[model samples]
Target: MTTDLGMPTVASDPHGHLRGTEPFPVAAHRALADTQLRQNLGHATRTIRAKRAAVVGEVDDWEELRRAGECVKADVMARLPELLEQLEASVTARGGVVHWARDAEEANRIVVGLVRETGSDEVVKVKSMATQETGLNEALGAAGIAALETDLAELIVQLSDDKPSHFLVPAIHRNRSEIRDIFLREMPDVDPDLTDEPRRLAMAARAHLRRKFLSARVGISGVNFAVADTGTISVVESEGNGRMCLTLPDTLITVMGVEKVVPTWSDLEVFLQLLPRSSTGERMNPYTSSWSGVTPGDGPQTFHLVLLDNGRSNVLASPDGRQALHCIRCSACLNVCPVYERTGGHAYGSIYPGPIGAVLSPQLTGIDGPDDVNASLPYASSLCGACFDACPVRIDIPHLLVQQRAAAVEAHGRPTAQDLAMRAAAAAMASPGRFSLTERVVKLGRLLSRSGRIRSVPGPGAAAWFGARDMPEPPAETFREWWGRRERS
Candidate 1:
């Protein structure tokens, strides 16, 4: 029931992301217009949120555990370069080859060249944000090698030619009916009359990917954590697909962000306890795959580990931005984000999405000229503190989002349109003389009003408030005028 998605692997530079000053608000406006997507996102997020809260509450020491997780990641980020070198040495000592990539382009090139050298036309992939950020599938497709996603949600997204909209749940935007449609249309041998039931869909995907699992010779993955002392890569997943991806292939290529390193196997123990509950709301993930380098006649005979920077060092340079690298990929922030609930993940226009994406994406990509989708990402949230509360690492996402917004505003030079409007309003309000002048202007408007409500007003200011709700009419006497007379007494 699986389609052979043989994307052409021809070498080409990935498309430069479109440039604009428009941030997530503009992007979300487009997404919010899609009623179907909003409904799907709201339902999914609410369900996951409740589940996570229940599980998290069951642990009496959840806050303490979360703080420990935060400190562990902070410790790694604080000493990133040295820890990375330690990780490289440990992996190298265990016969693992390590490649360092400075950015997405370099990372993709390294992986593409590695696949080409293996002389294999295909590679199986575990669900990985690093691979997504690099557009590895497109890169491999360019080189004439197809990268097959083995994770159920990722497989669904890939088959549909769609990007993932969530951190953990890649295809969370798609409901059962949509999933059935995707499976039916894209899966080569899927039954035409397959029911849109959840179990049915999973079974169909399972049947389709089974052969790919057995046949894939090269595996690509990103790690949840890398133990520096023991040189082990750990992946926690709900399904067993990661186990297959980790063990089945002959040559395993892992792409890990530099921040994923933990000092020892004992550190893995703490995260192993924290991650599953925080991420999937499970006491334990159904599967947690751990593997070292090569073992004679077991698993992959050749192992290549790509320790990716991909602009992480630049993020680490700023005190505020460095906190972003502490993320555990739990997706807790996504589940609690109101903006993510409305627009879903695609609107963020990066591999990272939701509250974390708002801050992380802009910084990771260096908030550049025309190519940065991340520049506008900061305004994606409503400044609600839900994401910070939900974070396993407690990243203070709302505070960071504000900082990134300031950065974006500064990048645009003097005042933006929104800024100018706010400034004008403040000037009118601040001066008693100006307030009286505005009151006289509004009195003239009240005479023309048929009712005590203003249904619409011309120009940019009215555009926002008039779009959804009615605007109340100006009072006969302004509040300031009343206050002025009382003060005179």
Candidate 2:
């Protein structure tokens, strides 16, 4: 077993942790106000949603396959610790080294130190969420090592120094013209005159990355799944860039969460069907690469697998919450999420965003245990179960959101106003006398209305409601009063 070396030290403060500092609603408020962002998000999500629906419709057994996938993941979690040791043993037997990481800082340190040991100042990267979650590029930058993103969208995000706005399409926030500008500005030797065309943009990125691919001695990646039976790691991508990064480099380091492991190769077949159809709306990815340890003179001879904990164990500890770890990162949940569609990914303030992020981030980091913003994540969703239906893994996000909200309320103590209001509401509605009195009070509220609408209101709850929406005027008579009059007649 290899010890995790060079782990980064994160701030110890709970309220001020990196992922929890930004509130989704606050960030989403700004994103919503940007008409351009709204247009971009609407267009992108609608297109992907349609495509996914079309492809998923082609499968007669899609629902069955989804259930199967979820089952395999649950099974993996059930036997996680034992399976991890089994995976470690299998990988070692196959000439691969395994390292364990407890958190993001440790994962980053292990990856950076591995690259440093390769004696390379540069490393080629496959589009990996784990690295992004750990801010690997930023860590490498601080160490004076350049980590080049080989995926086209990821390359665009890296070049722009912008956070990803979506899971599958990181550059979804930017249009073609914006991409052309980034390439022209960042790529030193690119042709000065570039057209805002998709083909041209792809070719330019290809040219820019080609040199790095050939010269870089080390490569870093995240796995879609790690099969324990054969000790194999898998990467699925539309672009062949992932394959290039996996194959071309002499030293390869893959950072994967412990939950990514499955018990056997057969279990991987279930995800192979679920991920592609859910994510890209394709029957199969163009490139599906699988490697088991070192292959003499074929691909990288030196292989290192970093198994990351990074709060997953905490997520797994909760019986109701553990399903959050079942996510395949296919991002199907994001495409269909109303909240994700409008707010985009950055609003969540974590690498993991969208419906999955709403539940996963809070649980992995804890609602009240860490960042104030993290605590606010449970409120990010509108409690719609669209995410649950869209999730190929069947993570009941609405259920998880409620659980996290309960957890958050417990941690911070119930809001006195809300608690008191609920108590008052229960008392009023529980009896006809109290209900009549409440209706009469609301009838008096007619005095506050102008133009047949209560455009604005004064109390905290009233102001909170009217701040975003207008409340219609209350009726002159309660239904009970009308019912009483009819009965007397």
- Most accurate candidate by TM-score: 2
Question: What is candidate 2's lDDT per residue for 98-156, written digit by digit as tens?
Answer: 99877777777778898888889999999988888777788898888999999999999
TM-scores, in order shown? Answer: 0.91, 0.93
What's the alpha carbon RMSD for model 1? Answer: 5.9
Q: What lDDT does the true structure give each of the candidates?
A: 0.82, 0.84
Best by lDDT: 2
> How close is each model in CA RMSD to the real structure?
5.9, 3.4
Clashes of 2: 1
Distance from true position, residue 47, model 2, in Å? 1.1
lDDT of 1 by residue, 228-315 (tens): 8888888889889889888998999999988899998877888888888878888988998888888889899899998766666667
lDDT of 1 at 26: 63
